[model samples]
Target: MPTPGGYALVHDRTIVAERRTCRFSWVLVDSGNNINILYRDTMTQLGIEATHLQPTRMLFHDIVSGLSCSPVDRIRLDVLLGTNDHFRRGPIWFEVVDLSSPYHVLLGRPALAKFMAVPHYAYLKMKLPGPKGLITVVGDYKKSLECAKAGSKMAESLVVTEERRQSTGS
Candidate 1:
């Protein structure tokens, strides 16, 4: 098990784990390109086989409630430790917390509180310091940014030019 702030060197570059409960067995994702995971070939990769993994309420750290009481089945992931700020102590504990409806889980100021979160924007590469070990966040920023820019431009114009090119903002 890797310690906090420690990197799990795999192949050449360090690899972070991407764990999720799919419709089949639990999946463990590794490698950026040509991704590999611990799952049988015949699987949907979302919920359990035959049955769909519907959103269900589960107990997570209650930041506001302080103690664990209100358990929610929100898909949003809540970061416990590894936030930007840290005292003499090391990273903090993480829990699968949830929030009420309407407040979408986004990389806003609060969600991006962790110093590593912004890296996801550039490449979605965030170093998540878990209790057992540190997991690197692998993300692609350039591609997403370009896609978003194009989408917004299209939304604003709602018209395709002869060259299908967008006019530079004047």
Candidate 2:
């Protein structure tokens, strides 16, 4: 069993591309998620054109709203984890979506399985096997709190805006 407040704690880390073209500052580590997700804005920041993305007909169901959301596209990128001396690199497929989020990317079970990474939410640490040895990545507590708070605010704002739209019938 996991300890309380784990949900409030954000599990994020820096992810570098094998090509060294771009680096993601905050990537949410979600073990419960089945698929990896990337924001369109982040893809744009990486200088990846929309035309490069492959079309995806998959739709994700939102647990909170029970609504189905379609992804803009899908992309495969080679991501490197950990430091230069000890790192794991692999190709991860991400469903690109246009939304407002606190983190740049959401790394789910697929990403974890690819790297064989184990995440401890309470401790805010993730460990994976590297060529030299085990590579451990620690999460920033301050950044976690900040991202959680921001996410909460964004959710609240969205709900309020939705309610207003419903009331206005527009």
Candidate 3:
């Protein structure tokens, strides 16, 4: 069942992380990430101090487009992941990456392992160990489709731009 603080939309599943209400589609479970990733814009919005972050030579491979990405910096933040009094896991580490993505944040294997979350993609649901016992988060199939379409369009545009740049040799 969906908790009051975190609920599934008619079109998408959303979670309340800290004080931010985020789309589940925005957070993906990818072991490759190793650590959680927060988009530059999101970091700014969260008012996270980035000056002290240590620079790391980390490369991010986008599963959607097979493109390589690099992080601008890395920061350790107390990331609370949960809703209400049910459960909360956090103050976790996250890498700051400057990339144009449809999602604001991506929660990788580290966060998953921390939360012991088991995702069931077929049912668009994920169950995690919560303070109460077990909690489930449902996804929105339609919203996921929308995000994919947008991401695909963005990828095509980037490819076209790159091709034009190479042809023009500018």
Candidate 4:
């Protein structure tokens, strides 16, 4: 029998983001999501001060648990996609949230639409128009598998902990 959080392996697409003085990799491409999200830790790592963030009253929901989440703030940052020879750079508004995720940033449909990008989940690739030609971003299968494993482990641990709490009536 399949274990909890151990379903069929799903291909998770990732991309690289380049800014003026920093570069980040393993940014999750989530087509089902409506907005882009930046983890708080990633913001700190990028040396972005909290004062730079703009206040927001938007609330988002977790697709799995149906839990509502309020973002800490929002920020507009220039994100460069693709290589030097072929790339697209634009300002993206990201909702900064405090959450634990395998990826530092989650690019949703909004970002994809801004870039006019198309993603092929089966092939683990995304393509967009670039200055020179079409820029194709390939995903790392090994990294995807690793992330799946880590997520599964985390979910299993949560279930075990919940069961223990219930048994102890805590």
Candidate 5:
């Protein structure tokens, strides 16, 4: 059984300590004194009792707010990560804050932190924000989660459109 705080995946937990990566200098993965963060299981995935993990909802404009009014706006984002860092790489329905840029997916602190995993060139290997490797909901995809039947289909269509753009540079 997978726990809510931590998961059972090796790839997701594994880290490249020696590597140097830094894509978002804007963010930081710090565990300094008084950080009170769990000493083990990465800073976010606390092995300690002091570090409390907070769960929150994210809208489309949360993370991608920086890309507003841009041509790449309105692109449906693969919910690369979700609240509680459970879901990864799937269609996440988020409310758009700005109509001009519908495709830009928002990145809350959670998404920013998780996707930062794996060092880029000169940063601490970011811990996996969401489920990084093989994750199966292990229930009913159609029954338990069906309200999304309509949105899921729409997301699929958007994905196709993005794929085409990536392949043809259009």
Candidate 6:
């Protein structure tokens, strides 16, 4: 079983696309896993034009819950992480999806492979090999807990709103 604080690896990230930038405090830097994900609303906020983009059908499942989520459409975009000099990365392709996760983005195996990152969950640090040398990113445990709390509240509200709508037949 993972420690309670192991989830702190989820931290802030800056995503740039089409010369537009969006900073998200809830970006999950997963381990060596291929679960790259992007929030639909976040993509829109970043000014990533989706109308012209083709959507691909994909299925996602919640491993912990053993439940299948709705099949979501995937949209591709070129995105960059961090800034230019110090902790910069990408122009890499990302597949966008609509997921109500607390995270705005989930950096998975591909990203980990690209940066050759080593994640230390206990220390809440992610180390990567930069062009010049090694770069380290520290996660904020408090922020992760705060975001999780907020997400849970939002989810509860959504459920209540849905129940009300169904009861009213609107």
**Model 4 residue 29 lDDT?**
75
Tell me the deviation in Å of residue 100 in model 4.
Answer: 1.1
lDDT of each: 0.29, 0.77, 0.63, 0.73, 0.28, 0.67
Q: On residues 1-170, what C-alpha lDDT tens digit does candidate 6 reach at each position? A: 23654555777787766647767778877775465777777787788776644566556665224445542555544444433577755644455765566778778777777767788888788888776677788787877777678777767776777678889999
What candidate 5 gets wrong by more than 4 Å, as runs, is: 1-146
Better candidate number, 2 or 5, judged by TM-score: 2
List TM-score per model, in order.
0.27, 0.87, 0.76, 0.79, 0.20, 0.74
Give the alpha carbon lDDT tens digit for every residue of 35-99 in model 1: 11111121222222323212444342322223343322223222232323431112211212232
Better of 4 and 5 by TM-score: 4
Q: How would the candidate models be sorted by TM-score, starting from the highest? A: 2, 4, 3, 6, 1, 5
Name the better of 4 and 6 by lDDT.
4
- Residues 33-108 of candidate 3: C-alpha lDDT, one tens digit per residue: 5778877877766655666577887786754465677888887655444455665655556778887777667767
Clashes of 3: 3
Best by lDDT: 2
lDDT of 5 by residue, 1-170 (tens): 22231211111122111122112111222222111111122321212122232322332221222222211111122333222456555422222232221111223333334354332212223344445553332222222123234435655665676678889998
How many clashes does the backbone of model 2 have? 0
Global fold similarity of model 4 (TM-score): 0.79
Candidate 2 whole-model C-alpha lDDT, 0 to 1: 0.77
- Please say which candidate is ahead in TM-score: 3 or 5: 3
Clashes of 4: 0
In terms of TM-score, which candidate is strongest? 2
Q: Comparing 2 and 4 by TM-score, which wins?
A: 2
